[model samples]
Structure formats: C-alpha cells, structure tokens
Target chain A: MSGADTVVWMVQNAGSEAGSREVRVCGPALGPDLRLARLDEERLGPYSPGIYAEALSALIAGERGEERERRTIVLLPHTYQVAEFAPLLAVQLGAAYIPSICGAGREAEGGGLRFRRAILQAKLQAEVRPRARTVVATLQSGAFGSDEPPASPTRVVDVCLPADMERSHERQILGREAAGAGGVDLAGAERIVTAGRGVGGADQVSVAADLASALGAELGASRPVVDNGWLPREHQVGSSGHTVAPSLYVALGVSGSIQHLMGMSGSRVIVAINKDPEAPIFSVAHYGIVGDLHEVAPALTRLLNERAARRRS
Target chain B: MLPRRQTGEWGLRIGVCIKQVPDTDAHPRIADSGRHVDDRDVNWVISSCDLCALEEALLLIEAAEQAGGGRPELVAFSLGPARVEEALRKALALGADRAVHLLDDGFQGGDALADGRALAAALRREECDLVIAGAQSDDLGQAATPAVLAQVLGRPYAWLVMAVDLEREHRSVRVLRELEAGMNEVLRLELPAVLAVQAGINKPRFASLRGTLQARRKPLERMDSSSLGLDPESVGKAGAGIETTAIRLPPTGGGGLLIDNASPEAAAAELIAHLEREALL
Candidate 1:
C-alpha cells in the first residue's frame, strides 16, 4: 500500500460492467479502499498517445485537487504500452516521471519518498528523490514481492474527459504482426547455455555453442547477441523473449540486463563466466568465474568430453 | 502543429537529438559527491541508440532523394558542455546538414523534464517537420526526455520505433513499433511528429575520410539559454522534478560463490567438481 489512503485503478479500454467485476475480484491487493475507472476504448477508439495522455492527465489532476495536502503517487506497471505514454502524462500534470523503479521507501531525514532504480545497465543502483508535488512511477517487472491484502469494497467512479475532447487525427494504428517465428522453445529446457555480447562477434558464437553441445543444453542468447545478428530471434531469452526456469543455466560472458535477469533468475542453479568482475550477471549467478571465456569454455569442453569417453570405456 | 518552415527547394527537414554519454564499456568511478559518475577520465562517445536514430534519419533522406522527392536536409541537435560539440561534429560527418549545440551553464544538472523543456524551445526555433531521438540513454536509461519533449512541443510521438516509412508526399509516416512478447504494432502519424528510435533497426555507418574532412568546414551553431529565450530558473537544477541523491554498486544475489582466479584448467576442474557434487553434470 506504501501508506496510501486510497488506490484508484484503471483498466485501459475495459468495458464498464465487466471492468468493475474484474476490479472487485483482483483490486484488493492494491489497498483496503479502492476506486475503479475505465478508459473505455469503445468510446475513445484505438490506442493513441495523445488521447491516452490527455485522458489520464485530466483524471490524475482531478484526483490531485481532491487530495491536495497529501502526497499523491501514481503507480503503474511498467510495460511497453505504459512506456510510450506515461512520460507525456507526467509532463501534462507537471509531475515527476520515474520509470522502472525497483523499490521505494520514506527517507529517514526529511521523510521524503525515495525510489531505487537500476542505472548503467544494472551495474549500479541510483536513489531518486522527486522534487514535485505529484509523482508518476512505473514499477519494474518482478521487483517487489507480493503480499496478501485485507478485503475491501470497491466503489466505481466515472472520469469525464473535457467536453471538447476530440479523437486525435495525428496517428492511426494499421495493425500488428508477430516479431518472429516460434522455432525455439527455451521454457521447457532442462539446461540452458546463453551467449551474451562478450562472445565478441558472430564468428565467436561457436565457443558458447560448443560448450552447450558438451553439456547437452539448449543454446540461448541475450538480447544483444540476437540484436547484432549473431543468433536468430527465436534464440533470444529476455522479457521480450522466452522466460525459462531451468534446472541448470550457464551464462557465458553475459552482462545481465535487468530484463535478461527477469527471464532466467528463476533457474535452480546458475553459473556465470565473464571477464569483468563488476558485470551485473555475477550478481544473479550462484557460482561465477571471473575469467576469459575463450580460455575457460574450451577447457571445460575438453574435460567434459574426456569424462564422457572414460565412461564409455 | 507548427507550420512547416520555408526552404529553398527541399521542404522536408528532419532533426535528430544526439546525446554524448560516457562509454558503457568504461568502468566509471563514482564522484566524491556520490551524486553522479566521476567523468574526469571517462571516454565519451555518442550513445549507441542515438547513432541509430541518426542513421534512420539519413536513410529517410536518402530514400526521399532516390524517389525524386528532392534532397531533404537533416539537422542534428544536442545539449551539453563544449565536449558535446565533438558529438555534433561527428553527426555532421555522418551526414547531418547542420548542427546546433545548446551550450550554456544554465542547462547543467537538469533531469529529463527540465532538459526536455529546454530542448523543446530549441527545436521550436527550427520548426522541423520531424524530430527523432534515441529511446533511452546508455548511462541514465531514463527514457523520458523524448516523450516529454514531444508533449511540450505538442507533436504526436512514438517510442521504440523499429521501422519508419515516409510517404512520398511528405505529409505522413508509417512506423513499426516493438512491443512485448514478440508483438509489433504498425502506426501512421501525420507530419510534424517525434520518434524515439530503438537500436537494432539498422547498422549505423562509419564516417568516410571525405565526410570527416568536410565536417570541419560545415556550419556548427551554438545557442545559449538566452538565445533560445529560456529562463535560468526553468532550464536547470531549479526546474528539475527529480534529483539523483546517490549512486552505488548493485547488491549481489544469494548463494554467491566466486571461484578463485586460477589457471583455466584448474578453474574448469573445480567448476566440474562442483557440478558433479550438486548432481547437475
């Protein structure tokens, strides 16, 4: 609850009746008192940043006016859709915009709220303090642990956009398409060996592949490897790719981005090999060897093969 | 939307906002203040995603030229101290027709909101038909400036743009945006729009010898806060909505067992033995 008196929930484009019922069922986790509102797409049309920002800004402004003395914190789940429009909403409301925050607490000195966010590609953590009266924060995926909430009754409310609100003519959605074919399935793999940017280049990807073959593990790749065309899109493992909870996961030269960690942090046992001691991948690895993958990978491969040969003999 | 600025022959004018950040590969030390990275010995480079944004603008202009739409001009914009001029010069070498450096002490120590406001003022002066920027900065990764700039300028905006198709008429553009879970949404926006490009859209090209030499002679304009009619209170730390109080190394995960640095064979044997003990081999 973060010490909020009330929590208002909005389900983008959800129908009024169905939206209310759904909120009652799942909205208790927010707080004991709830206010549900819907930005019905049926009335507003397809997703547009301009329209969505306008509507959301108007709603939050109205709420702020009602809760003028108290601190107003607008919380949202960080997602692709929210990433596109939340900044604009914050600008319209003259609020601070903090994206991908992992934790929060009140400062002991001034009693001001502070946010924790990953910076420098998750290599460092930054403590952010908002200087504005209102704040719009987007929570990073899987950051805060879940807790049970007390049961509470929900009261639905209607938010009125300005009477002159008009559909934006600036943009129109054409359609959607799949980003890749479903050729690789990393979710069900018992063991995964992921190659990251430190693999050097496309020609060097064979080093990780050989290790994977020795371990009888599926070959996976961090976003950079796939982005650089070193691997196919289907092999990508991250928030935008496959989320895997494998028995064993080996990360080779992977400087773990937060999104990459979110996807594979559930592995039962994780091992990382990289040249940099400060790499973020080491933070999540159960066993880490800070050494050159070029030397370590081939040595492990040779030893594994020799053990296999002895077993056969 | 602002009226299109008049040009001699080419009507399409595209502006790119490039940011010069500390190289991600560099091991930056925290300053004594604990507020930001100590950049005294840092290697600075144009952020990777910003370079891709510049490449996308260059590609758009080239495509327009090939279609007989006349030669469209590309302008690059950036805000920072004098070192940022180097980044703008690099942009010129890569094919930007002109460069604007918002150089002023008043613009220092600002967060995304204040910086966006200052940039919007500078951009309004240019009245470009289209504005482009990287979706996020490599150092901060805030990913807020472009959207705030668009909102301040009252232009339609898109984030994480993967592909851009300019209409021959120069009135609108179709863009493909990357979404979560392997989904892509296609959108069409009228002219006078802002786009925050994602990386991996294109491989940015290097500057040729001829281009680098020519860049030295190209016009690079510097604009101070007063030149852009910006108030000191509205452009810097005074106007920032948020401040970074501290930056520290991230905490490590549980079960952290760091293998001792040794010969490759020795390390490999130890790792294998651990796997065998865990019955994971």
Candidate 2:
C-alpha cells in the first residue's frame, strides 16, 4: 500500500480523560483517513478477552473490501488488554500483532511500514517489519508526543456488544475495589517519583514522598519496596505492577532493574538520583545525580519549595 | 461448551501453563544473525510471572483442602524443546501433582498464536476445571498465549488476574484483574475458564527437599505434534503469523548529564536549573 490503506483506532474508555488522550495521540502517526472505533466501556461492561475477540472479529469481517492485500492498523489502549485481544484480532484480519510499540513510520527502504519497540526488558530496541497485509499494535503510553494536530473529521463507529455475549454466562463482572491508601495512580500522573530498595529504611520513604509532594508527582515504588511492606501493592511499578508513561519520572535510589525499566521506559524525561554511579537507571536518565537519596531527596524538595515561594512572591 | 461442575473426589482440577525462559537478569547477547538473542550461554528458569501462576494454583489447592473439600489435582503444562522438561519438573517440585510436557522439533519458533493453538490442543486432553498461566512470558513478553489458548479452546478468559476465588458450590470463579492506575475489576468466570495471572499475586514457594524428591517420581507425560493431531502447517515457523525482520539495539538516549556540585543543596539547585532549561520543572 502507498500509505496506510485504512487505520482503525480501537478507543476504550479507560475511566480517565488521559486514556482518551493517549489513544488520540497515535492519530498523527496513523496518517489521515482514520476510522475511530470507540469500544464503549459502558456497553461492553467489564473485559472478557474471548467476548471482545468475537466482537472485534465480527466488526472486521463486516468491513466490505477485498480480503487480501489490505493494510489495516488497529490501535489499542492498555498493553495488558492488547495482549489479550491482539492475537484474536490479528487472526481475524490476517495481520501481525506487535506489542509495546514506541514508534511507527513508513519504511524508507521498503514500501510498507515499520514499528519500533523495546525488547530484552527495555535493554534493546528492535525495528520490526510486519510481512502481513494488516498490522495490529499497542502503543506504549507516552510513546508519541501529545501535540496532535486537529484530526480530520472522521466517523466514530460504535461496536455493539452482541446480545448473545451475555447469554454465555461464562464471564461475569463481580465488582471493583479501590487499590488502597498507598495506591498511586501512576498511569494518570504527569509526574512520578519512584523509590527502590536503595532508599534504605521505611522511614526514608517519607523523604521521597516529600519530594513527590513538592513536585506535584505521584509516589511510586519498585517491587522491593512493596515486597518489603514499605509501600502498598498499588504503589509498585514494574512487570508486576502498573506501567506508567509520565511526562517526568524521577527515580530515587532505584537500581533500574530490567523489569522496573520495562514499566517506565516510555517516560518522556527520566531523572535518576542514586548513590551508586553505575546504576542502570542513569543509562536512560536525562539527568543523573550521584548522592544519597536520604540527603538528595530532602534537598531537592527544599529547592522546589523555594522555587514555588519565589513564584508566589 | 458449558463447564460442568465437579462433584467427585477432587474439588477442582487446575492446569497451570508455564514456560522456561532465559533469566531476565542475565545479560542478553544478540545472536550473530541479529534476529534474536543467543540463549546458549544463558541460564533458563521458569518465567517470573509463571511462578506466580503456579503459586496461585498451589494456594487454590490449599484453600480447597481447608474447605473440607478433597485436595485439588494441579497439573503443570509446558511446550518447548527437551530442555523445557526442567521447568515442568520445577513446577511439579513446587507442588504440582503431575505435569504434561509438549515437546517436538516442529514446536520450535512458534509464535504466540501457534503456541496457544498447540497448548489448547493439549489442554483439551487434560479436561481441567480451570487453567492458569502467567500474564506474559518473559521472552516474547507479548502476554497473548493464554488468551489465545482460551479462544482456541472455546473458553472464557481473564488477563492480569491478581486474585482468584473459587466458589466450588457455584461452579464458578471470581477473579480480580488489575487494570491501569491501580484499578481492579472483579470478574466471575464460569468453571473451566483460563486466567493469565499477574506476578506478585502470591509469593511462590520454593520446593522443599521432600517435594523435589516426590516430583521426580510423579507422572510427567510427554506429547508431541502427532499425539495432539496438529497440522504441520499450523505450527512452528510456518504457523507464526508475525515474521521478525530484524533485531538491533536501540539508540542510546541523550548522554546522561551528571550534576556536580560542592554540596547537596548546590546539587539540588543545579538539577532544578537543568530541569528548567529542559522545561521539565
């Protein structure tokens, strides 16, 4: 295809405005002539991968076009959901499903397109080529700049959840619970300050918390912090925890384990503060400070507070 | 097919799908071909999240036993080369009653979908009450296998499952799925459902010496492509829907600028100035 033959953006209401924004940010990269397929969360109710797959299959099959040599791009919101849906969608549309895509662009050498994603736990980035006619991918949060140009007026198609979907009774939504006090909504936060094991005692976590408060950032934790009971499960960020793509991610005393990096590598700007100079977090950090987080965190908070005072004056 | 309730000696027959993956902490060396990483020198272990899934199954078995119901039979399943038997054995050692190893030369390089199809085929033979797998494998990290297997097997599925509660009396399971921003959705799935469990849902127990000895003697069945009656065209490289064109290291980020100052206060101020210059503060 010369350009993208057709782009289908699967927009899911993630119960947050930022979720919608993240979906829209991929529009520019998808090129014009975008078709917005809004997956109404209210209608779909809770997520069941099987039901969603059937619905998506029906939607794609309903499209009237030549079966072969058609290029389609499907954009998904959450990576976890993407994992659940991509394979089924790819099978339905005869596409290649790529996960954790950070960038996509027309191939300079080849006539088709290419995608860029991190592999080896974010230690390496791979440029991928989809041999299939259709390509399905989930863009990492914060991968694309949010400065999207006014999109071309496009039709939003509402995918109705099939009546038979409820008849199965195989999948049910019991209820939802709050993540708890230490639970930080890292995905929605523009700024995040994360603490790791190197932060020492649980009491020292307050120092990082103070810095986060000064910067108007959410407080996040590596696996060890949560494992050690210094923070709640929801505060944890890594393969096991929430994947956050904030504007600014400040790592305090974190050694930047590969699993932790996998969750936060999409941040626009990363700042690392660690006593050890060889910490891997510095590799991806825009700025680094080699100092004890106990002292550095408090000092940074103080300076930020002073800046705020200066602004007030 | 509607899942039938259990009314026999066992409370629930649970199948846990696990994988042997290169340790995530190991230094990854891109192969000479650059299409994939060289695993020859890397030590392989059970994918981290898979351990959590195994632990979850073990916990469920314990819960069933405590509820006055007979102990549940937990089966660990894996598909890979001969080396993968090690991982299945580890699962057995960790408390699985039995294991099914799907091994064949043709099984190599099967993408997530192909692997799922093969696994689903194997699972049909086991006829378990519930199937659990890691949210995603550490190697591909696509997190698609269990969901695809559920679809192929015609079963309901949930992903990123944080907690699973079995209501044996109701012939159903209630699972808490972790979503974005610390939000969790509680799902009640009928029996015979598949769940891709998240890591840290439970702390995986190390195998006791006694458990390890028992695992060696436990039944570990081996099946291949022919035993499952799978089509040759639908597995391995031929079955892979996505073809990897190239693999190369990502370009390094901006040179990490270390802020040097005489005092902590000075360092903090310098960092703020840098953030200001970058319009980040």
Candidate 3:
C-alpha cells in the first residue's frame, strides 16, 4: 500500500520549473477526496510544487466536503512493476478473487474465459447483485493521482522505497503520427460493404465494388481477402482485425468464424448473404439471404444502378 | 535525435485499445437455428487480459508523470456499438480522462481482417505514441489482431510482451517479448510502438468510488467510418475475402474404458479377457 502515513511517499519534482524541489505524498489524493479540511497546507513542498500543485489545489477546492476515506492505496512506481506488484495489490485492495475457477477452464474453451463464463453466465440470467466496494479495475494507459490520501496537497511527507526501479528493459513512447491520409476507417464507419471468401478472389471483388458503389459506402474485406492478397492489409475485419461499429454492415460470401464475428458483432444492422444457410455468419446477421452471391450481386447491382440512373433522369 | 527532457527525463503518451466482448458463458441467447450466439442479448464485459494492457499503459503514464513531470494523458478508446460506451466508461473509471468510440452501424458486418483495418485508422487519427492491447481476447482464440494491426499501420510491434519499461529518460523502451518457444526476446524499440500484452505483464487497478464518479464526467468522442472516408465494401462480413461454409457445435463423444481386475493373477487373466473383449490386445 502506498505509504498509509502521509509523510512516507515524498519525492522531488526534478523536471518542474522549481529546479530542486521535494513534495510529500501519503497516497493517491484526487480532487474528489475528502480527508483534510483545507487545500492549502504548509508542509507539501518548497513553494507548493508549482503548476502540479496549483492544478491540484484548484481541483480539490472544488469538492466542498465528501468522504474520501480509502482502506488502502497500492502505489506502483512504473509500468514494469505492475506484474510484480499485482498479487500484493490485490491483497491491499482486499479483492475476493477466485482463481482455479477460470485457470483450468480457459484452456478447454480454446483460450476464452472458461471459468468466469460458467459462474457469471449462470448468474447473469438473473440480476447481478452489486458485490463489494472492492472493484478490480484495469487502470487506463496514463494517470498517476496525487501523492497524499485526501487530506492535503501541500502536506509534505517522507517515504521508504519498497523496491527500487529495477526494470530489466527500458521503454518509452517517442511520438505518434498517422501512417498517411485516411481511406477507410472501418471501425468508425457508419455503413460498411464487406466481402468474404465467397467473393472468390481479386477477380471476384467486383461484386463488392458494385454494392459499395450503390450504397455510397466504404468497402471492407475479411481476413481471407488479405491472406489471399486480394485486399490490402487495411481492409481486413474481425477480432484479430479492425473492430468496426457501423450502422449497416453487409456480409457477402462470408462464413462467420467466432474470431471474425467478434469484430463486427457490434454493428447495429448486419446483412449477410451466403449460399450456406448454416454458415455462422447468419447467426449474428440481422438479415440473412440463403442465396448465391454470384446471382445476388448482379441482381442487386443492377437494381442499385437503375435506382441511381432514375435519380439522374 | 531522441526527444528528451532538458533535465534528462523522458515524457510519455500511451493509448489503450480495448474491446468489449460478450460474456460467452452467459449464453444470453441462441441464434434463430440455435447454434451461434445471439447478438441482441449477449451480456458484454470489458474483456479479459485486455485490462492488463490498460494497466501497463496507465502505469507507464503514471511513472513518466511522476519521474519527470512529462506525463501521458490517458486516452481510452473502443470501436463498437452505442452500448459499448458503457464499456468505454469502464476504462475511464480506471483513470483515462477521455475516450473515443467508433460507434457506427457501418462497422457491424465485416470479418476480422476488415475490423483491423478500421481500428488502425482510428489509432492513426489519435496519433498516440503507444498503443497497447491484450495479446489475445478471451472470447476469440485467434490471436491475430495485433499482428494485423501492426501490419496495416506499418509500425514495428511486439506480441506477447512480458515486460515493458521506459528507462533512463525514455529515449527508447526495453521490451521482454515471449516468442513462440517460450523464449524471451528483449529489444529496444525507438518509441511509439504497439505492444500486444500478456496477462502476467501487469497488475490492473481497482476502481475507487472517486474514479468511478469521475468517469461519468469524462468525455467520449464518437466518430464514424464515413467521416473517416472508408470504402463501405471493406467492412463487415461483406468485406471479408473469405467465406464460411457452415458453423455448428460438434457432437460430444463419451467413451469409458473398463479394466477387469479380479486378483493379481486373476487380474492378469481379467486384463487378457478385457483386451480380448475390446480387441485391444
């Protein structure tokens, strides 16, 4: 637990405007926390730790009064320390964890949540009662809260290091720039015209072309298209590919593998056409056509062309 | 030249790509013919092991902020339906300040490969330094998203990342990757690399009431593929280049072997009899 006593987790902000400075932190104190009576405390650091302190000061002052009491706070110094610190972190949070349940079952389910599925699935049909205060949440990519508990941002405290930063490997984020101009962002697309194995090959993609052109939609390809080199790397879809949440997603000649299904299952409307009625793709599809794509494509294309032509006329 | 802090500290920006999956065990509903999972009733969760990726990113950001004050503001993102906003908020509860949701009906139909292309585009738009994800989703056994995303994005990436660290001022990162043979390969990538995370890689945090309430206030940005200008034919099952002939849960077989053992000598005779019965001898 990050120093329960307010004085233990103190460190200096070497990178701040104040060249040489020290700040005391007891735990991760947020603006919403309510341990101390006032925001301005004298012992936090030399000159209130600058902008870091100022921003925090304003944040905490907003919360008039609330209970900010935490049983414990697990302070992990860096990313590499999480694995080493998790067991103890769980302990500190008092998480009632059940392990053997899923560990043995996941292997059997082809690596999915085997144990949790049975337990939660059975109960989910019924109302899931809110359990305990201890919530096992996966923190996002960034965000280290304040140093103190909820008491004082300006309070200074000393700390004893648990384990020094002994990362076997060093890591950092340099900069992130887009590869280039966008063509088709399937994940965010409102409507997607997707082709599958049924499309046959590069020669058969014309069907998708027609449908996409008809709808004025972005074209997408399933995994097989990329593997066959019929579609570019950017067009593949599935759990292992781009997870799109579009409005009208049309599936042509695609069999629904669970892996592939997971990617597009979030769409609002799923329209699928395949000769095989039993193809898994139809299960999730809002509209399923048990027909040959070869015939369907030309018919649909002609109809769409007629509609467009009539609009021009 | 390496982008460095004048004071010898490294700054970091990290992004966590999360997927919301149905609680498969929930068996919410059966498809019309009764084989596959029904989309309407699938109870979803933030997904397994992906949280570990989020943990890894948050910690990296925290450390960077703490060490040199060059911190990463957390951005949690997901591509799914309108309902997935709840799942995205779950990430925010952990510490992310903002979320991006690609919640459009157009993305609903494609296969996995098509899905990867779309996600890569969203990430490209964000322009984040690092994109971390669970090595493989618990629902789907196909551990193919990361590699495909990396391929599409044209960025160097490592899968099954066991350990990740930004050391000695964050110029580059030293990564411990688990290769197929259970061997560990440690390499330093310059920066802005994708890391498909392993379970043992990090300990995820629990949401405090404060964080949970804060998530309600965080902003979630929703965008569509149309705005991104993607070709509609390239999404959903229609976008899949491959076709599925059929999907069905196979029949289970139960075979029990019987051993005839009366006594040691008698047992030998029984074994012979049993083997003779089964034609195993």
Candidate 4:
C-alpha cells in the first residue's frame, strides 16, 4: 500500500450554527486534522464551481515547504460537482488530473504509484501514472468504502477563503429540481431484472419482463433501453436514474456502463446473460451465461413457471 | 430564407469542438506497445455526444434568428491528424458556417491538458463568443479536456448540460444540468462561457444533399503550433501530466462461475439446479 505521512480533511459548512455541528461529527472520524472552510449561502450562495476551484486551489497550495516535496495526492468524491471543477483545480495547480479512478497500486517496474481507471464506457481498464509530482483524482463512489479512523491524532490547521474572493459572476445558480415525477421506487426491491440495449426493440423487452415476473423480481431498465423509449424513465437504473442494491440482480443483455454498474454492483447476488462474452457486466457477475437472451430468457421463464405449478399442487 | 449573419461584426459566434473517435461498436485491440488501443484499420466517426453538442449549437443559432436577434455564426473546431478534416467537412455539411482544423505532428499523443492548451490557443485567436463540446469522448472517456480548455480560456464551465436557452439580448444562457438519480440543477452563465453537453440533449439532424454540396465550397482553415504562438514542448506528449503505463481487460470477479451456451432447455435446467442449491430460487 502507498502510505501518506500526513492527511487533511477539508469540511464545508454553510452557517456558524451548523459549523460547530460539523466539527463535532467529523472531528472523531477525521481525527484532529480537519480544516473547516465556511461557504455560507448568504456569502457564496448555492455551490459554485468558480468558488470551489478557487477555495481548494488555495488550500492545497498552502502546504509547507518541507511537506510539499513528498508529493501531494488530492482525492475527491466522484460526484457531479467535483467532476465539474476538479479538472479546473488541477490545471490551476499544474497537477495531474485523473477522474473516475477505481483502484491504486505500486507499479512493478519502477515501484511508482499507479492508478486504475475505467475507459471506453467501462469496457476496458487503464493503469495511469502521474508525470507530475502533484496529482488530482476523483474516486468513483462505492469503489472504496469508509476507512477506519487513525489511531493517532495529527496536527490541524484551518484555511480561510479571502473575504474579497470573487464570486461566480459569469455563472449563476437558479435552483435544483427533480429530473422526473416519482417513478417506480426500486429501492426496496428484493430482486431486480434490468433490461439493456441488447434486449433489442420495444417488442422484445417482454423477454426480460416475463422473466422478471416469473422470478418475482422488479423490472428495471438500463439508460439506453429507457432512452430508446422501450421502458419508461422511472424504470431506469443508473447514476442519472436510480441506484438500487437489491438482494438479487439479473442483468439481461446489459453491457454495464460505469454509471450503471456503480448503482447496482452492490447487489448481493448478480447474474448476467449476454451474447457478448467480453461484456463488462460479466466482470461483476456471480454467475454468467454467454448466450442470446431471446433463447435463454424464455427457457428460464418456462422453468420457473413449471416449478411454481408443482409447488402449488 | 434564413437571415444572413456577417462574419466580422454585430453577430454572435459560437465555436463547437468536435472529436473523431473509433466507433464504439468496434472491439478495441491493445496495440503492441500496450500503451493505447490499436487505431489501424478501425472505423472512425464523430463521437455521439459531440454530435449532440454540435446539434445544440445549431439549434441555438436558429432560435436566435427566429427571435429577431442577430443571425449567429456557428464555427466548428477539431484537432487531430489529417483524417480529422473529414469530421470538419461533415460538421459543415451539418450546418456550420465555417471550420477550423488544429493539425500538427507535434499535437499527437497528447493528454487532456496538452490537447486543451492547443485548443484554447486556437479558440483565443477566433475570439469566439461561446464554446461547447461533448462531456466525454467515446474512446478514452476521460471527460477532462473541455474543463481544462475552459480553465485555460478563463471562462465559466458547465458539464452534463441537458437544456440551453439563450436570453433575448444574447448576453447569457439558462441551462439545466443533469445530476445523480434523475436530479437537475438550473444555472445561468454569461456569454463567452463554455458548456460540455451530455448525450440525449437533442436528436442531431442529418445533412441534406444541398447542404452537403454547399459544404464543399466552405472555407476550411488549417493551423499549426507557430501560428497559434504556442511552445511546441508545452502542447503534446512533452506536456502530458499523466502517462498510461498499460491498458488491459479488467480482472474478472471472485471466481465467478461461467456457464457455456448450450441448448436453451439444458442451460435453463443447469441454472435452476444451481439457484435451488443456493436457496436463491
């Protein structure tokens, strides 16, 4: 493992009242090394990419001379906001920027630190090494669960933003709104069967839907299936749609984009059926069948129905 | 007839960056060096998301014209080897007023930062009122160049944009940005900002025969490193911040069982027995 001698956690709080609560909550887990930065809505308004890039660039640059030579790795959660401004921050600091990173290790050749990132819509993986001393990377959510707090408390320093730091005059935040009306709530589902683009046309979606019905599973749809109008927007399962972690997840004809996999990879048991053996979905599946869904799905549905009939008699 | 907009003054100019990528349908074979995908004999096309960005630019210009605003000029920009001109010509056929190509041997093998620097230099020369591009490329899928370009150009940037509405005076634009789990945030950016459009924003229109014919006469300009006043060392492989040590297939899951295809009945029977043994059926 690549170990860091020093670690710093920057916490963002809106108002003075909530500021104390954050310190109380984050102090224990993050230990003594917590830096609080105030971004009250009254002063900065809703989250602005301009303010974030400026604030973070300053904080990261403020490291002492002795600490700077060891190399700095700035890790951000791969959320929508971080995805927007992290690259800009990297440019401002002249550091390497690698987004959607899933893993890290030391390379065998030079023993240099390397990061793993998904490419080609998660169909392939690339091991990237930073050419610069400072690196900025966004870790894909769920890729790394919460870590245990440190045994020893470290030094802490608070970094404040300039009182006259410019606001985002070029961009203004209007408001946030839900993408669609409350669609099918799949959060509580025990089992889910998600149909993907390889499921073919709207008429062919029944192959997966029937299997879902026979297995007593909720019907889910990948982004492309929903985008093609084969399924409604509510049934969509992905980062931009719904994040579900059911007990069982059976992906039918799904190629498994990164966003889609992030949402459902936490399921207890995963089964993938697709004609393409190289499909990324198989990488995460507990059981996989390489075959046409049209043939495999109907056969499974028939077997389930026969078993149900026998149980009833 | 569409209201004509002059090139130099009193008209808004929107620059769209387009990238040609290997078709997603083609399986990428790792090259011998193991640093990147093998580009030989691969079919290339304009990335789907970038096509949406171009379509959005054309729509905004048309809307401005219909609202009695000045006819907006749409200029398409692309940076790549000689084959990139094909993508630029296609952009012209799709309704762009002009096209600019940033081509040079020095620009090859660049990371996002290097590529963005070269693009920002060319865009500065054009004095574009606005810039737009796809949120991510279909090949590398890095999704960083646009943001880097925006930072280098010192402009406000918005990613995963779903909707765009320009103000009547053409001073600012209102856009909706896509967030996780079907959430959206509405934002307004002043003119001269950059936007990274997401897929599914709008359906791109196909080129008409007349449009294709007229595109042949459209002026296509080529630019090199010296012309853009950029140091060659700071704009390509020499300036890259990250190095790809290797590209390989992802490791499979924890000893996952792989069942080969057989007769549908036989496969289904095997699956049922396995599920039953695990008490999952």
Interface RMSD of each: 1.7, 3.7, 21.8, 1.5
Pairs in steric clash, model 1: none
Q: Write the per-residue lDDT of candidate 2 for residues A98-168, one digit (tens) a residue.
A: 87777877765555577787765565567777765567787766566666643542667777776665546
User: How good is the docking of model 2, by CAPRI class?
Assistant: medium
Q: Model 1 off-target regions past 4 Å?
A: A1-45, A146-163, A306-313, B1-10, B276-281
Cα lDDT tens digits for candidate 2, B151-194 = 78777888888899989778888999876545788989888889
Could you give the CAPRI-style class of model 4? medium
Candidate 4 lDDT, tens digit per residue, A138-199?
Answer: 76755653343423224433435557686657888789998766746777888999999999
Which candidate should be chosen as best, given lDDT against the real structure? Answer: 1
Model 3, docking class:
incorrect
Give a tens-digit lDDT track for model 3, residues A261-310.
65687676677777765565766675556667777666666665665798
Whose DockQ is greatest here? 4
Fnat across every predicted model, in order? 0.82, 0.66, 0.02, 0.81
* Error of model 4, residue B114, in angstroms: 1.1
* lDDT (Cα, 0-100) at B92 in candidate 3: 93
User: Could you give candidate 4's per-residue lDDT for residues B1-281 as a string of tens digits?
Assistant: 12334843345789999999998877888899998888898898999889999999999988878777467888899999999999999999999998989999999878999999999998888878789899889877778999998899999899999899987465888999997777899999998889999887888999999999999998788998999999999877888899898999888765778887578778888888878876788
Which residue pairs come into collision in candidate 2? Answer: none
Q: Which order, best to worst by DockQ?
A: 4, 1, 2, 3
Candidate 1: tens digits of C-alpha lDDT, residues B126-227: 878899999899988888999988999999999999999898564899999987767789999888999999888899999998999999988788888888
Q: Please report the TM-score between candidate 3 and the true structure.
A: 0.43
Residue pairs with clashing backbones, model 4? none
Candidate 4, residue A246: Cα displacement in angstroms equals 0.5
